[model samples]
Target: MSHLLDNLTVHPDCRHFRGDLPCRPNKTHGYVCESCPVYAPVTSRVLIIKLGAIGDVIRTTPLLRRLRQERPGCFITWLTHTPAILPQAEVDEILKFDFASALQLQARQFDVVINLDKEKEACALLNTISAKEKFGYALRPHDGVAWPQNQLAEHKFLTGLFDQVSQANTMPYVQEIFELCGFDFRGEEYVFDTHEDKGFNWNQLPSSGPRIGLNTGCGDRWTTRLWSDEKWISLITQLQQAGYSPVLLGGEAEDARNRVLHATTGAAYLGTFPLPQFINLMHQMDAIVTQVTMAMHISIALRKPTILMNNIFNSHEFDLYGRGQIVGPNRECVCFYRGTCQLGTSCMEDLPAEKVLQAVAATLPAATILR
Candidate 1:
């Protein structure tokens, strides 16, 4: 596998810590392992720290699978803010921490503490953990730290670190993290084990035809990623005309938005359920139609057919979650990992309702539609 730097030109600021720091070898610094104390190779007890958005948490599932497989006996723990989003089989323990109380998180220790969060506080907390081996992105230029200024770069850097240690080239960057930790890196996609069976009442739902779960609301900037109410109404009308039931799902915060959407089209909108219950609900759908968010991940994890309507700044890495459908604008979306679109016209808006509906139909198999 090629190093991250090999594929892309390094930013000028990244040169300072090339070989000396934990980053890939470039003009910057050298590897930091020489002076760093080598922890005795005891049975692995891994702790993965990823305090990121819901979509990001879902994307990390492959990493978890790899780590568990490499060391079957190793105890793996996950430190994440949204523990509810993590699949049931990913880790042995889930340590949920609030960013507001980050300092208190240092109390727990493990054999290896890998910090996947980008915030400076996450780095500070890594220092506090009593783990024998500490690995994470370098916020400031440390004598032996890796620096990744952006989200895509960070993913590449972290995966490179795992590759360096494990010498595994077959697995992707995220999966490499697990392989490096001595875990199996194949199969078992992202999964959510919801205790409550909030799945749709098949009897209550129209028993006659295919059901497509429509999910709006990206949670942060509501207006940017979502289609207009009118567009949703049109899409629902078209789907219904084509013999499909569009089940609307979203958070309580989106209740009003969904109400307007439902009222406009007379669709069955199940608004604002709890996280676990929402996931359970997802299992009932034949396929999911959603914007780029946790819903896409959840639907994919459940093995339900899905169609993701993405914005300009969408990350293709999300495709790793499932063999689902995706719809987006026809324009060249330059902002791959930007938190928000800088361009005046958000790319998602460019996607026509007809185009989205067509993509969905094309992606779902005849059997899936019949089911």
Candidate 2:
């Protein structure tokens, strides 16, 4: 009986141990926990809850680097809406924001839980999560309002509350998140899984000259950041005249407008694609020019030379990783984080195509001088 019981003993602490089914090591090598040569015990269990926009999820990946450096062999579980964007190699498990995922998370305990989002639902979830230590925002039980969980999170909380404080702030988004989690930002680069080997072929795109991607729309949510059609035409003409191949890029939201732009300027518009394919397509570009949208984050992650057009938000909030430049209008924008322009006329109009051309020229490689 004792020998039979010994055979049934399982090592739950082992990193390769999975309760549901046979682990990879056991399946591959037929090694029991006692005799496994590559056995690795988990040091810590960490949970990150960041159910925000897709762009926010992409930018938040830098924190994973800090976590791995500080706590080696830690098992990390991340909860986000954009699970496809998270790198599977970095995260032990990726949970989407849904009732079932929430229930599973609430049932488990973690050594540390960090909620990077400030939405009421996210804060409320953090309140119910079982963790020895918690960071970032949490819901106030008394008033049911979100508040900073610690001193480090206070700055981010305040910035979200007031536009003046946010505009005056100079801390980059990466540094702010690191400080919130009691870690110093060491210029860790984003961990984006480009899925390059997924059989994507971009042979038809112009190969000789620098292929410049012109992301057309800023999304419908932030129409205040939209550049005029005439400006896009001007920029495309200028780029073509300067010997750079201009390619228009956007999602379904900008498909119609991109077609119009392509027709007007004779630039290349390959149509929009799903997220994964779009990422791989953007990878082929030599440089990117986009407004403050998801493309900007993708470009940053891919480390492509980017010219980021800005108007509403503080330019300091972005960290381009030394590979990009943020260009704003000549005049100050009256809209600060507002979806619509307060002046009834957008400041994006003030951002001339010539200025954007200059920024692109400065950001691209020196060899990209006219064909």
Candidate 3:
């Protein structure tokens, strides 16, 4: 009876908790652990280490949902730099990585530790942590280098150095992420706690129809994915003529660019807001037209019909959960995994504005003015 508590991580909700009321294999009670109320959870303290870009951090939440289902009341502590977009309800605690947090993590204990980031620092940190089961990226120890801890992780790990390997891969990011963590991807939806901005309301606007979001900026790292200012103006004008209200969406860097596009095209510019507020703004759109960026992932998580344009990144890299299309360039992408186009002109220029308008019309809510 004492061994029961020692061997299994018990759930607080179990009715027969003590040795006195131990679960029985009698005719009245099912002997199986799956149906038994007192069936102990296998996992307790789970640590998830994923740090970096807000988009990657946001998309990684689906793994939380899957992990929660496997073990009841399992306390999860996630390490990340961007906590703004993460859903608070899913994770028990969030440890923002620093020297103190690193030291704390090295000292603490976890039943399962999953480190998804391949950065040497992250891998080195994982090597120092104490856990019964460790998965994903690991350190080489002597030289302080990173490598895959398991076979599943090897597939995604190889994509970093080899272009041909990445091109040959058909696995979606979430699927590979889950595999790295030693779980199957079940088409889990992204978990996001979209906090609304107090006064930013689109309903007060003078215009009509369904509000379509035009994500006008790609991040600085992926400059090749950006569409020209002229193309954005053209798309906004076309959207207006087609009876769809276009809303320009972006961060601080995009404010000036968005202003120019808004003034020239008469598109509504929702000024730069915090990540949470930005999510609130995105939620108001009937559908979102975006490049391969964070907003696109956010729109997909919100279940808003998304129209995504891409050229550089692998088409299979995104799942979009059957809610969007991966519109690519007409010609073969000359640059892969590169920030700037070596050919002088970006391949994203080849994406026609007419094609985008058609997707907007097809996906727009019935409230929009029909063509």
Q: Relative to the true structure, how large is the alpha-carbon lDDT of every model?
A: 0.65, 0.90, 0.81
lDDT of 3: 0.81
Position 305, candidate 2: lDDT? 90
Model 3, range 1-371, lDDT digits (tens) per residue?
36676665544433233334545442357444445654544348789899877788878889989988986668788998876667876776787888988998999888889988989878987888999889989999887778988787898899876999998889989998988887888899999876653556656442577788899888899799998998888888888887778899999889999999978988888688777778888888778999888898899889888999889999898887988677877788979989989999998898878877777776764365432
Better of 1 and 2 by TM-score: 2
lDDT of 2 at 168: 94
lDDT of 2 by residue, 1-371 (tens): 36774666677988788889999998998988777887889999999999979899999999999899999999999999889989998898899999999998889999999999988989998899999999999999999999999898999899999988999999999899999999989999999988798989887777667899999988889899999899999999998887788999999989999999989988998988999999999998889999989999999999999899999999999998888689999899988999988889999999999998888888885366434
Query: What tens-digit string does per-residue lDDT give for candidate 1 at 1-371?
Result: 76876655433322222334345442234423333232123256777778877767776776655565566557677777888777655466676777544554566557777777656666666666777766654456465344653343444465445533323334444453444344444655764565454434445555546778888677675446767777788888888887777888888767898899888887887666667767877777788888767787677767777787876432434553455667787776655444566786666767888987886677664345553
Ranking by lDDT: 2, 3, 1
Segments in model 1 whose C-alpha atoms lie over 4 Å from true places: 1-42, 87-90, 98-109, 138-188, 196-203, 320-322, 334-345, 365-371
RMSD of 2: 1.8
* TM-score order of candidates, top first: 2, 3, 1
Over all chains combined, what TM-score does candidate 3 have? 0.86
TM-score of each: 0.71, 0.96, 0.86
Point out where model 2 deviates above 4 Å. 1-5, 366-371
